[model samples]
Target: MARIKALVFDVFGTLVDWRTSIARESEQALTPLGIAVDWLAFADAWRDQYQPAMEEVRAGRIPFCKLDCLHRRNLDVVLADLGLDQLNEATRQQLNLAWHRLDAWPDVSAGLHALRQHYRLAPCSNGNISLMVDLARRNDFPWDAILGAEVARDYKPKPTVYLSAADAFDLRPDEVMMVAAHSSDLAAAAEAGLRTAFIARPDEYGPGLGESAATVPVDVSAGSLIALAQALSTANTPP
Candidate 1:
């Protein structure tokens, strides 16, 4: 086992619940206009846009884009495809910015605070730097540092994103662990020479989150970052 000096976390669905936060705001943004849409459904659709959008960028069909722009483009497409047309340009932009106001999971702040006492904890997320900073301030996340894919000019699963942080800290790959609710994120971290820890965010994708993203059936699942900190603490002890 390796000594984990720092823990890197995924923001969306891990440190913050993008689905619920965005959907709640989406409802408020659209209800006054009588759009009659399921904001939750729209939120899910917005999240679903991530993979294909990244694929476009990865394939060179699109130029390099930040997660914020990717999210904004998807928001517009979802609104139009769902027949929602009442929003003015400014309002649409406001609605698109729901990404900036994500709510942290119940234990997130407390957990991160507790962990910060022991390790150099920071976010290693695909969100743009400005968006992550705003979210930290909005949600009061006590992260010691904020690492964004935009800083690397690439996204996770690209390898460069993970390595850039390692390069920044002047640490070897094994010294960092990526904590995430999504297994795909953990898998990427593992591939990047970082350790992997899965923190359960059961409601991340809303109430019916499936086994595909759930942790109950996974191998290295942790219920919270507090638990993750405890586990790492134990691992670091001298025998």
Candidate 2:
């Protein structure tokens, strides 16, 4: 157990509330155009395309591209599926950026602030660098850097994504902790030799639609980023 020098995070559900945020942003953008739909279901429908889209990239069926491009592509699919294909290109582009305007989880600001006192922090998200920047600025996230899929030219659960993040900080895999809400992500990071932390986002999908606990073993498990920071602080405290 080497001393963890940096903390890398999976941004989507772990740090921010993507589902709710997307739903809100979607309603705000689309309502102006008289598009009436169940906005929450719209958010779910759009998110449903996420994994399959990444699988296309991960499987080499598509050339590597930014998550923004993928989001735009997925947005097209969702729009067509929902009979909202009448939207013009400019409006579509605006809606596509809903991902950029997500609100962070309530505990995020205080937690990141606490953790930043002792460690380097960055997002190891599948989101492109610009997307990460937008979310960071929108939420006042104090990222020391942004390193993720676009930087690694691949998506997560892939070893390179985790290892590349470790390399970005010039730290050994064991010296970096990968914090995420998903157990599968932690399992992948563990396989890649990085320490893992699970911050449960039980409502990530909607009310009670997220995991309350990690299904896989992790170095740390907590209810929120603030709790995680406290757990790490306690662990580092000398007896």
Candidate 3:
């Protein structure tokens, strides 16, 4: 196998707990308005539209838009469905940015630090640059550079999105590992000639709703980012 030189990650479910964080923040933001829907369900409903919204751009039905814009549109639809559409613009904007404040998983900070010792790290997410930067600061993720959807003007599992990340580091596809909890994301990266690492995130969608394993084989599979880091460190150590 070619030596891996860098690591690019999937942000939402892979590194951050989007469901729990969004639900918590949404409840905090919406409680003032007396809108008492199931916040977790509300989060799921909003996320349910994620891929389809990206598909619109991917298929040329809409031009490229940041994930924040797509998230705002998705938020409005959910609010309308919940019959709580009376929220003012400021409130809606705050709620829309819930994605920006998502907390990293417990293992992420240390794991990324460890991996950063041996490889460059960045988020190759569908999230735009500003969103990724905000999340990185919020979570203290140490990334070498930001590269993903906005940079490519496209979303994953699009080939351009994956290839663009590799190009950003001036590295060949196989020299950078695409680390994600989602099998399809890794599959797309594999198709683009990048190496793959699957880190299981079984609670990404709220207990048991996330994937525990990759649907296909990957170059590495671990229970968390820390495990991946340890495995890689061990592999690189000389006898």
Point out the higher-scoring one by TM-score: 1 or 2.
2
**Candidate 3, superposed: residue stretches over 4 Å from native:** none
Candidate that scores best on TM-score:
2
lDDT of 1 by residue, 72-115 (tens): 88878887887766568888889878999888888888888888
Clashes of 1: 0
Q: List the RMSD of every prediction in angstroms.
A: 2.3, 0.8, 1.0
Question: Taking the tens digit of each residue's C-alpha lDDT, what string does model 2 give over 89-126?
Answer: 99999999999999999999889999999999999999
Runs in model 1 lying further than 4 Å from the true structure: 208-220
| lDDT sort, best first | 2, 3, 1
What TM-score does model 2 achieve against the real structure?
Answer: 0.98
> Residue 72: error of model 1 in Å?
1.2
Backbone clash total, candidate 2 = 0
Name the lDDT of candidate 3. Answer: 0.93
Error of 3 at 18 (Å): 0.3
The candidate, 1 or 3, that scores higher on TM-score is 3
| Residue 29 shift from truth in candidate 1, angstroms | 1.1
